[model samples]
Target: MQTKSFAALAIVALGQFIAGASANSGYAGSCTNIQIYPPDGNTNYWKIAADCKNNAGQTNLNTKINIDSCFSNSNGALVAQLNGSFHSSCTNIILTGTVLSASCRNTGGANVNTSIDTNNVIGNADGALYCFNQGNL
Candidate 1:
């Protein structure tokens, strides 16, 4: 009887352990909120994403950084001409330094505005001139 009780207890403990493990599963999606810097009268492009977790035995700093582009513009006006789309479920994205060549028309800049689920400005959002600043990375 004692042995049977021990076996039953072990099974219950194992079930709880598995459930806890499953509850901690992290999210998955393309990284977002990446900013890059470029020299004057020049263009630069790059792609960045991250997969991080806050626990031991779990992989931390799974960031992938790569140079995705370069451009030729000086007045900083050409810096906001980049065209790309990335989706993610993670929070805490950082865009440090200056951004590179990126530009977006009213409709083209929709990705940036929609990424945060806001209708701030994208040409006709409240009749404001939408500015897509991709250089302030």
Candidate 2:
């Protein structure tokens, strides 16, 4: 009976460990100590955090993603309207939990693709609507 009780306690301990690990499911690792002037918002300032980088080997990686279509919904969720001219030069636009990656044809019709940080999207999203309509962002 003592052995069975010990085994149950061990199982409970393991369960608590797993629960603690999963509580930070969206933990971001790419966040660095570097600081910037603007648009440097976290995934709600904590928890998930990372950097947003433009495509590889591009002279002007600052290619602006016209996020004019993004807006806050009534439900306090982010609505990024992607379509039409937004992806006109790109294909293979894939959104992962970490990044919004894509592949696209360059000016010479060659495929040039890169991924930016999805934190920009999430941070740019209705981040102001944090918790009961009160946000520190």
Candidate 3:
């Protein structure tokens, strides 16, 4: 009986360790107050508005960042222009039947390996966007 309990405890500890190692590790920042406005430039383009901030993890020191993106349902992610000193990593923005999924990023250089459910953005309630400095790391 003692052996069985020890084995079970060891198994639980190993599981926790594996889960922690495989967890989603991000940079020292996050994107908040994300609001998508309808069509800023063309009628088929949706504008991006959010409050983002990140430490110098993957990109430069971004106290506050503004990420402007032209995302639409018909045209997908058209353009991502940011008003900061970082690279726009918003690629493959696909609007799969109202479920928009893109590698939305605003970083100088960073690498992140997380699952699809890790959330890119926050405050949207329904879904999450992985935006570290409007991006992720």
Candidate 4:
């Protein structure tokens, strides 16, 4: 009788402990914001700044930054001329284009990722004019 009660209580306690552990198991990192600006008079040259929450246990930083110049046609999408993964400490970066889009991911532990969609720009230039900045990472 007493033995059976002890066994039941132990099982209940184990179950509660497991549930509590699972509730707290996940990645809790995020990027605050991504800012883009033209470095020179040329709109084709852009600089990017991204702020991230450097949560503990985070190892790698993966980023996909892009620029999309809106044109009259459907082929005016410009990707990041140069983008890749690095240490989480590498926050400041550069992306060149008239429009901007970006994604930042923290990996190697719990996983947290965020992205920014491409922005559209309207002007009196031909669709081909925007192609000057179109390229891949």
Model 1 lDDT tens row, 29-50:
1222323322234433333333
TM-score (C-alpha, index-matched) for candidate 3: 0.24
What C-alpha lDDT do the candidate models reach, one value each? 0.29, 0.35, 0.34, 0.31
lDDT of 2 by residue, 1-137 (tens): 99999999999999986564343222133222212111235321112223323234212211122221222221222233322233445445555554545565555666655665434333211112111111212
Scored by lDDT, model 4 comes in at 0.31
Q: Write the candidate numbers in order of decreasing lDDT.
A: 2, 3, 4, 1
For candidate 3, give the lDDT of residue 3. Answer: 100
Leading candidate by TM-score: 2
Number of backbone-clashing residue pairs for each candidate, in the order shown: 19, 0, 7, 0
Off by over 4 Å in 3: 1-29, 41-44, 56-137
CA shift of 46, model 4, Å: 1.0
lDDT of 2 at 129: 12
What TM-score, computed on C-alpha atoms, does each candidate reach? 0.24, 0.30, 0.24, 0.24
Worst lDDT 10-window in candidate 2: 124-133
**Candidate 1 RMSD to the real structure:** 19.0
Candidate 1: which stretches are off by over 4 Å? 29-137
